[model samples]
Target: MDLQQRINAFVQLGTFLREISSESISKTSSSKFHNQIPQILQAAQNNNRWFTETNIKFAFASWGHALTETTINSWLSSYSITQKIPNTIAIIMAGNIPLVGFHDFLSVLMSGNKVLAKLSSNDNILLPFLVSFLVEQHSDFKESIQLTEKKVTNFDAVIATGSDNTARYFEYYFGKYPHIIRKNRNSVAVLTGKETEEQLLSLSDDIFQYFGLGCRNVSKLFIPKEYDFHPFFEAMFNKKEYINNHKYINNYDYNKAVYLMSNIKLLDNEFLLLKQDSGYSSPISVVFYETYEDLSELQTKFSEDKDRIQAIVGNSGIAGEIPFGKAQQPTLWDYADGVDTMKFLVEL
Candidate 1:
């Protein structure tokens, strides 16, 4: 199949996904993806506690809007997608968030390479369902896709996503192949104390979406000295329902107890905890915050440690910074770790 054919197939898949999301939620699914939603959602939830029906549907909605013809065309515009000898591109997915490695899969197929996906045990359900839809739309996809439970081998290149420790393992094993091995990274938001309540409310999505599991979810905040957090706390109240989840509550309670016993000062709202920390990766239900005096100095510091950051969320207008609420809604070109997956695949 040509690039246009692949794009058309994905567009069809996107439409099906969006329609099914609405219909399934309303108990009125007539579309192809509708009948399968229940089985997939149930399987996902059973495999991982974090994969609630709500989060799964949110993922569906995001991809449904993302995999459109316009977005696909725009993303591919800069590259020549041709296939003379299609290489096998193996993907090792991370299950922290649903369908996390799908962009790599899409990149490989769009560039006319075959995909050998080793599904993370934590994220076993979502991608395969979408892959089934793709195969149904274009039977040729069956030849281009492989889902394996065994160790990955016989691949021309590898794209693996994992934490820092696992990243070292990936490097040791897959170093010989053309690879994009990712490490632990987190997003951050900066506040100037001038943001409107609406903006802060939107920023709450950056912090709480996917229960703050995704790398793109903001885990840290930078605020001006002596900043008033009253408005920020009020804005984040929208996500107070997050406390209802036992896993999240357990983390909050445990972390809060640790801080209390250690006599570490913290700001708590009976749900979320804000601690004065310079770290970017915060525990669930806790947001680490640091005080910044100079915007230029902070920008410079972030630039030096760019690899550790996934997205910079704020209205600060820092170069390539993600807008207040857009940390989780990255475009096709928002390559993780600032590495272009499509470019890597095309070069491979």
Candidate 2:
């Protein structure tokens, strides 16, 4: 009903997620939600093979850490948030990783607005189930959230996320409305050949987490010229278990085959492929590398192509560069595309 009530409900949801994440849901906890965890997890994996239990749980764990009362208050404190008439905001979600569109959903409701969400089929299970948990926390939330299969209309504004092609469609259809339309963007890492083994191993998480599907996943690397691949490959060895996922292995094999057939020189570690490329987006099991002459030049390049890049990960001193391994662990205010979702909603 009110902002505090909404925040309280989400705090409850966060506690539930933390319990599930830690495998410590007490017997006296909300039995219905707790009992449904296994089914929800199974359905998520069944619906999208990319939604492995480990990754889904990690997503939950990340959100659990994020939705604390202190953090939520701190994030929202910057906005005025005084809307007398709530707008119905439609959200087009992306299922690349678990709950990828949740920030928008959270923003709408927290800003005293209704949500009309079109959940990506690949991620349909988790958010709706969590919505059920939230509604139970406060019945008022039921009227605030709507999940739909038909064309989304009767909304005051739109926030859509999709590939570059779908973005064109979104632009054609929803461009007239107050909107934020996002397209394909990738994250990259800068390796100065000075990172410690621990840092490199952590950086592997930035690369391989969610099998490199999320926009935040580091799909490219900027290494100094003549930087040996041996240490980098060795650090990545810690994530060799990713090869065990059949879907991931299939991509690795198929991409490797295609590259080999094309006569492209590749550095292979049996599980992952390293290729010299000038591009940012790489195949699922491959990471693109480019040699950098100077960090200042790379920063200038990133500045010029800011829209195409989501995050720059490293200690290269690039402005807003995320440290290694923390790309996926974005804070509540870490807007995707660097556009403030809360400001957009509040302004509406």
Candidate 3:
């Protein structure tokens, strides 16, 4: 399909998602796939317990909002999306969160490349179904998108996301080809001890969303040394219902017990645990905090460790920091790992 055709297809898909998530379908554009959403939601939850309907729908809503014509055009305006000899771009998607690999998929397609996608077993359902809708929108897409479980082969380039261990494997296997290989990265929030109650409550979303599984979820905090835990804990109370998720609660209990056994001092609010740690990747249901005597010093540390961090959430006036509660709601231009996928693709 041509570039405009591709853009139009995605715009329609965006409309479909917005309608499906809101259950206010009033357009015939998505009629073919409209009835399939409920079944897809159930099947996704059944296949991956972490893919609760709420999170999946939230993902849908996020993508729906992002895929609008205005946003898409604005994002693409800087690029010269000229039709080129199509290259096959194979994607190794991560299943940590719903549609985590979608931006890569969109990048490859929008750059006029063929998609040979290896869907993560934990998240194999949703993207293909959406691709089906795209194919229906324009028959040309039927030849452009291929989802597979077998070892991917014969691609011009590769984009893979995984843990540090799997990233090594990806490098070994796909290193000969042009590639973008991403490893484990976590987001962190900076607390100045002056944030309003509203901001802290919003920060809770950065912590609890997706059960803290996604890379964008804040796992670490940089707080002033004398910062009180009272307001932070109280704000976290907003998401106390996370305890109702059996899987989440199991992690909390297990981590809490393990920490207690080690005699590690912890601040517990019954539902969440806070521990002093120098590490970035905290366990699910636990957030690591480190006291910062100077925000400027911490900023320098972040600069040195940028590769290990996916995002920084705060209003500390730090360059490139994401606002609290907006970690999961990245704009189209927010490249993961700070690598520009479209630039890489088009230049190839």
Candidate 4:
């Protein structure tokens, strides 16, 4: 498809997503397209423990706001896109969060690159359905997307997202091709003692969303020395229902028991567990924290380990940091792993 046709297809897809996102919270929509959402929700939950109804809806809501024509246009404005000979790009998706690798899929296609997707077993259904929807909107898309489960070959370049262990295999296997291979990374929040209750509540969104599975989810906190845990715990109390999810509660119980048996200190609020550690990647039910006497020193420490960090959430002017409550809502331009997929595709 041509550029406008490609843009229009995604715009229509976004409109369809929005109708299901905010208009009806109980899957009560009468639209033909909206009716399938419940089935998709069921399949997603059946396939992956982390893909709850609320989490899938939240993912769609973020994408719904992002896939607008205005936002797409603004994102593409910085690039000098031309009608180049398209090449196939293989995508190895990670199924940690709902529609986790959709951004890479969107980038490759919008940049005039064909896709050969090896869908993650945990998330194989939704994106293919979306591709079919795009095809229905523009038949030109029919030839552009090729979803498969076999090994990814017959592609000029690749973009793969996986854990730190899998990244080594990807590098060894796909290194010959131009590629962006991602590894384990986590997000952190920097807190000043003066944060308002509203800000702390928003910070809870960053920590609790997706059950803290996503790379953008705040898994660690950087606090000042002698910070009180009462206010922060109280603000995050609204998310107590998280324990209702059996999988999450299992992690909470298991991790909490381990901490107790090991004689480690932890601040607990029944649902979430807080331990003081220097690591960026925390467990599913635990968030690690550390004290920083100087904000500048902490900033410098994080800057040196940027490869291990996905995002930094704070109110301070800590270079390239994300504001509170915005970690999960990345723009099309906020490339994951700080690698510009658009630039990679256009250069291909």
**Model 3: how far residue 284 lies from native, Å:** 0.6
Residue-level lDDT tens digits of model 2 in 156-242: 999999999999999999999999999999999999988988889989999999999999999999999999888999999999898
Of candidate 1, the 10-residue stretch with the lowest lDDT total is 23-32
Kindly report which residue stretches of model 3 are placed more than 4 angstroms away from their true locations once superposed. 24-30
- Cα lDDT tens digits, model 3, 160-180, are 999999999999999999999
- What TM-scores do the predictions have? 0.97, 0.98, 0.98, 0.97
How far residue 324's Cα lies from its native spot in candidate 1, in Å, is: 1.4
User: Worst ten-residue run, lDDT, model 4?
Assistant: 23-32
Residue 212 displacement (Å), model 4: 0.4
Clashes of each: 0, 0, 0, 0
What TM-score does prediction 3 earn?
0.98
Q: Please list the C-alpha lDDT of all candidates, in the order they appear.
A: 0.90, 0.92, 0.93, 0.90
Q: If the candidates were sorted by their lDDT against the true structure, best first, what order would they fall in?
A: 3, 2, 4, 1
Model 3, position 146: C-alpha lDDT score = 93
Task: At residue 287, give the lDDT of candidate 3.
Answer: 98
Candidate 4: give the clashing pairs: none
